[model samples]
Target chain A: GGIITQTPKFLIGQEGQKLTLKCQQNFNHDTMYWYRQDSGKGLRLIYYSITENDLQKGDLSEGYDASREKKSSFSLTVTSAQKNEMAVFLCASSKDWGANTLYFGAGTRLSVL
Target chain B: AQSVTQPDARVTVSEGASLQLRCKYSYSGTPYLFWYVQYPRQGLQLLLKYYSGDPVVQGVNGFEAEFIKSNSSFHLRKASVHWSDSAVYFCAVSPNYGNEKITFGAGTKLTIKP
Candidate 1:
């Protein structure tokens, strides 16, 4: 079975600092996505990549940027961390661009102070 | 825009008791619905999904969900829940056309007491 690996399970950043999270999936899925989960809120999509170098903006992509440098790796960047901000960033991949099943990574928790 | 709603924020049930979690969605056309479970500090795992054909779909851990198009609801249910069933459940939906970006509900935290 393939696994989705996310780096730096816990992340702490100072206010106004830039932070990055990385994800790698060995499933060789064609579509990758970045989602944010806030306390008491549903998971919201940030950005998605259909293939290498392809990017699509989701409803909550304002302060975030994503890159799919390779088919197996996708990364998310927070332009500027806000104070008192805490959330979990989740990475998911699917075999197809349609409504296929998704495999998720363990997630990276971010804390801004 | 497609949206999902999970009315209950938290539910407590005793072990071996029947379980039911409600989920509702707003969509214009045919909808693709899914139920996902997330254990404490763990990633979300797909429990069941409904696309077409059958309205009822069975999933892992003896979980199942029934999609009622007339009511725009897809509720998850289990015959007998276990203590390990304590987790957060999310309901999600994707539009039938265009992009496949999924919209999720706020989630319902299930606490199964032994």
Candidate 2:
């Protein structure tokens, strides 16, 4: 079975610092996504890449940027960390672009001091 | 403009009891619905999905969900829940196929009593 791996399971950043989260999937999926989950809130999509170098903005993409350098990897960047901000960033991928099943990574918890 | 709503924030049920969690969605087109489970500190796992054919779909761990298109609701049910069923459940909806962003509900925390 293929796996989606996320780096730095726990991330601690200082206020105003830039942070980066990386995701790699061995499934060779064509579509990848980044989402943020806040306490007591549903997951919000930040960015998605349909293919290499392709980017799409989701509802919550204001402070985030994403890149798909290759077919198997997608990365997310937080422009600037905010104090007292804490959330989990999740990475997911699907074999196809349309409504298909998605496989997810374990997620990275971010805490800004 | 698509959204999903899970009315219950938390539910407590005794082991071996039947369980049901309510989920409502708002979308203009034919909706694609899904139920996902998340154990403590774990990633979300797809339990079941509904996309046009059968209204009822069975999933892992004896879980099932029935989609009521008329009511715009998809409710998850389990004949007999176990302690292992304790987790957070999320309901999600997407407007159309292909690379569309899915909207998720706030989630319901299920606590199975021993």
Q: TM-score per model for chain B alone?
A: 0.97, 0.97
Per-residue lDDT of model 2, residues A1-113, tens digit only: 79999998999999999999999999988889998998789898899998877899988999888889899999999999999999999999988786778888999999999
TM-score of 1: 0.98
Predictions' DockQ, in order: 0.68, 0.70
How would you encode candidate 1's per-residue C-alpha lDDT over B24-70 as one tens digit per residue? 99998999999999999888999989888989999999999999999
Q: List model 1 lDDT by residue over A1-113, tens digit each.
A: 89999988999999999999999999989999999998789898999999877899988999998889899999999999999999999999999787878888989999998
Best by TM-score: 1
Alpha-carbon lDDT, every model? 0.92, 0.91
- Tell me how large the interface RMSD of candidate 1 is: 1.5
What are the C-alpha RMSDs, in order, of all predicted structures?
Answer: 1.0, 1.1
